[model samples]
Target: MTDQPPTLPTSMRAGRILGPGHTVVVDVPVPTPGPGDVLIEVARAGICGTDLHILDGDYELARFPMTPGHEFAGVVVALGEGVRRSALGQRVTADPNLPCGLCPECQRGRANQCHDLAVVGVTRDGAFAPYVVVPERVVVPIGELSFAAGALVEPLACVVWGLERVRVRAGDHALVFGAGPMGCLLIQALKASGAARVAVVDLAPSRLALARSLGADLAVTPDELAALADVAPLGFELVVEATGVPSVLEGAVEHARPGGTVWVFGVAAGDAMARISPYTLFRRDLALMGTFAVNQTVPQAVALIQGGAVDVEPLVSHVLPIDAFAEGLRLAAHDPTRMKIQFSFGDASS
Candidate 1:
């Protein structure tokens, strides 16, 4: 016999970005799961740089009047027809990328490059609310993991995908620009992937301190970036630009060793441009690449967190209730001391 389904609220308060720089919380009817989907009761949802872009209407894919949250962890509260992968009460997180299967990129196993990609927060309602409905195929069990760390799996998955694409040889020295949440994640992921030493640069002392504590061999402010050369006289084997600042990205290749690789993992403004000397890349034999949002790497991120290779809780500097959605987004956008900001839901209907 089947267990009785729990009662759910008809209406729930959700955060919505109506337009550029305009965000609000409104009471909307809770969404029902369609066939092949599962309804999740969100426990924690993170505010990412992408969310900031969406708030400012800077991300081309973001739709106005949309709820802006995709990185999240929660429990499966209800299951729709044909949903067998996720069951009621299963603790889980999901891959928010919705790539069209017919796309050539998808056929080639590059879903992030899907021409008609429909991301959860960008294209539809997301987890900045009590309930969010996603396809069962994207849901992955967290298996007793804390909801806060579970919420970080999505971002870490992006890191994992980048790692898979980049070259991380054993004992290679690396330099990373930016020590924010994604930057810190990159530091740990690089170390775990066999980088012998990692140096991080940031303008925030607090972030530098956190990066050092989290396994960075060297952490320095932008004013002291010259100190990095002392750690690697020949320059780092790998250089990463994680600040999403055009100027920072422009100079990243200068810090790479001859024949080294430069990984661009930042989310810069759509119209932003960075000038780099192609002659320098040609002379140095440098390989420059970029990885976008999570693409089939959630399972690896889950493994990294569960196996203790990555610590996500330390990156979360703020956790507020859904009532403070705007405050959370504001801090995420302007707070220099902030790392990861998340919204929690104690009362699912609240």
Candidate 2:
């Protein structure tokens, strides 16, 4: 049986980006879910690096006059025709990527690279508002999980997909650059995956401290990288660049041990270029790979969080209501101390 709220609003205030570097809060009609879809009353939505790119017109797929938010969790308030998999009032988070199954990449099980992808926030209106329409297929039920933590499942799912693509030797040492939210997730996941030691490097001391608290074997500023030699004299077996800075990625290859792997997991600008030595990779037998957004790994991410294998709520540093979106954007873009900036929606109110 489909259980919905007694009354639904006819309109709502949404965060809209009219053009590059322009945003406004406007009243838009509350969207109705179509067949196989569900209307979600967003509980929390986290701003991501990709959202910044969309604001700056760096992402080619972003549609102007669009709402930008994909990392979110909410309740299924209404269901559309043919949507029997999801129930009203179910707490859930969605996989934002909507890959066309007929694409060559999707046929090969690499759906993340779908040629004609229709992402929730990028190609369609998203949860920057209190309500969003998502296909029931992508909505994963997050039972009893806090909305704050549920919002983080998308980012963790990215790390889980990366883990599947790379080979993690038992008891290997891993070095992660950038102790921000993604870096912290990497460290804990590595530990749970049997990595004997994981060290994280970031310029911010506060972030390093957080990394250390989240099970990082060692967390140090870039200036203190020399200390890592004592732990992995030959070099680390795994080096992950999570900073999305080209300079960091260019230097990442130098720290990988012979036969080690360098995983590029950060979202760099599309036009940005990094210089690396092909000779070094060939001589060292090192593997270099990059994994995009989540594939069919949402279930694994939810399982990881539910089982206490990874702690995500501690990574959230800022939370604001939808009306303060401008300030939230400013802080998310320029605040040096910010970790994850999320918008909390109580009842879709202003």
Candidate 3:
């Protein structure tokens, strides 16, 4: 970890979301970390579904004219007042959500539900810039893991938190609706959680093909769901709706066994509603649950990615530089075959 120069830059290049469907790369003043904070040189930033929502002005928590990128991995370049230099030059990824410690939700150990929730890349400027400041507490050292793997920790952490909320038992049968990056990760995590057989459902053959390569016992189109009966005659013990489509939830519920659990891990529109039969849930003793962002599971996620339990490399389909970020966003939104599109900046060590 090398010590940084005392004088910080006046301005740095950044991708800003100005208004709905409008974004551009602009020069923004480099932010100084407050006490108990550290500055990171952005290395790689992942484009996620939430980013699309933010760009569309659809995410409730996001404010306009801010740099947008929450999933990132970087190197610590400068330490702030009261912060140790131990992290200087160290590679790391972070949990973006910043909670008010005094909030009732924080007090209840539910910081994800914090009343005054401020998140990097949303409520505050984020890592789309070459350099950004973050609280020291949220940073997790990447150790020997690649920055690409590090950038994935946040999304994997979300899956870890969702697994905590959903009851996944050993030898349980699982069905994941969606073979997208997140859904594919959910498949691996569910398998790692001890599901005897993890079946996948997707509209795309290519995605489903990759799902098979990633260890999915069965991958099929919606019309082929009947084939899943060979593996689980009754129904899947755990059914996860990862597509974030209201109609998918209905199908997910129908795939759950009596007394099974249906976990909704995707982020649908704030006003979107999913219709499910209350009678079926009551009659079958089924549980329907939803999960939000990462809690305290980044470490476990790092372990999974670095430990090789979950494979993330194949999920990456596009790696564009910051200058082409607008094009990257467009491909991420419209490209059907693309899995994960990320923006990789300068060398993390530089």
Shift of residue 263 alpha carbon in model 2, Å: 0.8
lDDT (10s digit) by residue, model 1, range 25-134? 89999888888888899999999999999988889898888998999999999888877667788999999998898989999999999999989888899999989999
> Taking the tens digit of each residue's C-alpha lDDT, what string does model 3 give over 39-72?
8988888899999999888999998888989988
The CA lDDT of each predicted structure is 0.90, 0.91, 0.88
**True-structure Cα RMSD, model 2:** 1.9
Per-candidate Cα RMSD to the true structure, in Å, reads: 2.0, 1.9, 2.0
lDDT for predicted candidate 3 compared with the true structure: 0.88
Per-prediction TM-score to the true structure, in the order listed:
0.97, 0.97, 0.96
Off by over 4 Å in 3: 1-3, 6-9
> Residue 58 lDDT in model 1?
85
Better of 1 and 3 by TM-score: 1
